[model samples]
Target: MSDTRNAPHVDMLRSPLGRVRGLGSAHRGAVTWWGHMLTSISLVPLTLWFIWSMVGLVGASREEVALWLTRPVPLALMLLLLVATFYHMKHGLETVVEDYVHAAAPKFALLLAIKGISILLGLLCIISVLRLGL
Candidate 1:
């Protein structure tokens, strides 16, 4: 341990090149922050509409449910929610895997698996919603 008064403290907000002594990659914090903001903004209305629609279906009959789901706008919205939800899940899970998984191969494998499963589940849910509409 060196003298605390003279030692420099790490600044997390600074670019890697500014803080680091040697080689550093270009900063991507802003890009990641924008991506997160976009996802969050898109999810807000999608989640609200999905919950509201489900509430409306609570006591609906089979035909009523089918008709409601089959409408073009609702079907499209449902599909959009399915895709967006899965994408968000994939992004979150990737962050978790990257943070916790230490080994290279396992991290890569887990990330790939999460992405694959998210896509598959998203597609399945979309198909089910479409089928209900039909």
Candidate 2:
């Protein structure tokens, strides 16, 4: 055991040049993080609107519900809700897969599936809403 307690931190072992050269965020992390944050923030109001609208339509007949959906504002908001929900879900699952799934092959497959399925579901929802509205 050394005395005087003057040991330098491990990070101090690297030169400034070495520190600068080391692997950083690769710049994509912030973009993904910000996207996740924005989607989540947008979801709050969108989700509330969806729930409230659905509550109002609870006792409505199929034709009545369809009639309500035909409105432009409701249709647009529904499309936005689907897009933001799927986008948010994709990013959340991707972060989980990246953090925990160390195997490269599985991680790649999961990420690809996440993106594909998110897009597919979002598009399907948009199409359904369009069919009802238009």
Candidate 3:
């Protein structure tokens, strides 16, 4: 029972119960951290592929771009990139809001808005990609 009152940094105010339980109430543990890292790593390759693909599309007509996307591999890869990106973005934004937004109401509102917009726009993009394949 060292005095938390005299603790220099002030973050040492955990209850004995909190210290013992380890996971505490929030309980995300390493999973969220690992997911964030994995998504970050995955984005590197996807982003590079996207940049190259766009560069190739630069001088092309819309019909040529559409034709390129109509291939099975390109269509699949694009969908995977979109899904991973939107999922990663949602988690990252949620983490930012959770860490920075102190007010509960605003945190909840921002999280809700983020999830909603991510899903809506992601679906629209996926649909657009699919249409190009068609």
Ten residues in sequence with the least summed lDDT for candidate 3: 22-31
| Tens-digit lDDT string for candidate 1 (1-134) | 76888788765756666556433343334554456667788889999998999999898898897898889999888887787788788888887897799999999899899989998998889888888987
lDDT of 3 by residue, 15-118 (tens): 67676775545564545667778878888998898898889889999899899999998888799889889989898899899889999899899999999999
Q: What is the descending lDDT order?
A: 3, 2, 1
Q: Residue 33's C-alpha lDDT in candidate 1?
A: 49
Candidate 1 accuracy as TM-score: 0.70
Question: Order of all candidates by TM-score, from best down to worst?
Answer: 2, 3, 1
TM-scores, one per candidate? 0.70, 0.76, 0.75
lDDT of each: 0.81, 0.83, 0.85
The candidate that achieves the highest lDDT relative to the unseen native structure = 3
In angstroms, the error of model 1 at 122 is 0.6
Q: What is the Å distance of residue 95 in model 3 from its true position?
A: 1.3
Show pairs that collide, candidate 3. none
Model 3: residue 79 alpha-carbon error in angstroms: 0.8
Candidate 2 clashes between residue pairs 3 or more apart in a chain or in different chains: none
In model 3, where do residues sit more than 4 Å from their true spots?
A: 1-25
- Winner by lDDT between candidate 3 and candidate 1: 3
Q: Which pairs clash in model 1?
A: none
